[model samples]
Structure formats: C-alpha cells, structure tokens
Target: MPLMHQLWLLVPWAVFALAAGVKFWRLTRPFRRQLAEPSTEQVRASLERRWRADQRELTE
Candidate 1:
C-alpha cells in the first residue's frame, strides 16, 4: 500500500477522537470552572450537606 492510503485510514479516527474530546470538555466545563478554585470552607460545607442528606435518606 501507498503512504497516502495509510494516512487516509487515520483521518476518520482522528476526527472521532477530536469530536469526543470536545464533547467531553464542553459537558464538564462548568463543573471544572466551579472546582478550579474552591475554598476549603465551601468544600467542607458542601460535603457536610450532602452527607446529612444521604444519612436522612438511609434512615427513611
């Protein structure tokens, strides 16, 4: 086979990978923004709230 044929086979795979990466980045972009610089107090409060909610659900 020629070099061009080998290179052409990789084009579809490259396109698929690029599309997947963009989709994943867009989907998680907001979450990443919020977590990029979270404060310790904020993190603790969020975790505590979630834990309390879980405990309540378990008791029900």
Candidate 2:
C-alpha cells in the first residue's frame, strides 16, 4: 500500500475516536435539550450505514 493509503485507515479511527470523545463529554454536561431525537428511521439508517462500512473495512 502507498503511504497515503495507510493514512486512510488512521483517519476513520481518529474521527470515531473524536466523535466518541465529544459524545461522552456531552453526557457529563448539564445542558437541557428541548428537542427530541428526529425519528427511528433516521437513527436506524445511520447505524446501518455505519455498521455496513465497518463490516466492509474488516472484510477487506
């Protein structure tokens, strides 16, 4: 693999790590939200997409 190609693998992990960090940080905060989660469909679709992509990475 090329040098840049190897870096591609690192990028996603970095992004996920950042996202998790942010989420966990949010959980520790005391902000009250006036909004509800959009919908089950949207949530499911996002999770499905994330799962599929992760699966493809592992399989490849």
Compose the digit string of candidate 1's lDDT tens values, residues 1-60.
Answer: 999999999999999999999999999999999779789998899999999999999999
Which structure among the candidates has the greatest lDDT?
Answer: 1
Which 10 successive residues of model 2 have the least lDDT summed? 29-38
What is residue 33's positional error in candidate 2, in angstroms? 16
Residue 6, candidate 1: alpha-carbon lDDT: 100
Q: Judged by lDDT against the true structure, how good is candidate 1?
A: 0.97
TM-score, per-candidate, Cα-based: 0.58, 0.46
Count clashes in each candidate, considering only residues at least 3 apart in sequence or on different chains: 0, 0
Best TM-score among the predictions, by candidate number: 1
| Model 1 TM-score, all chains together | 0.58
Q: What is the lDDT of candidate 2?
A: 0.87
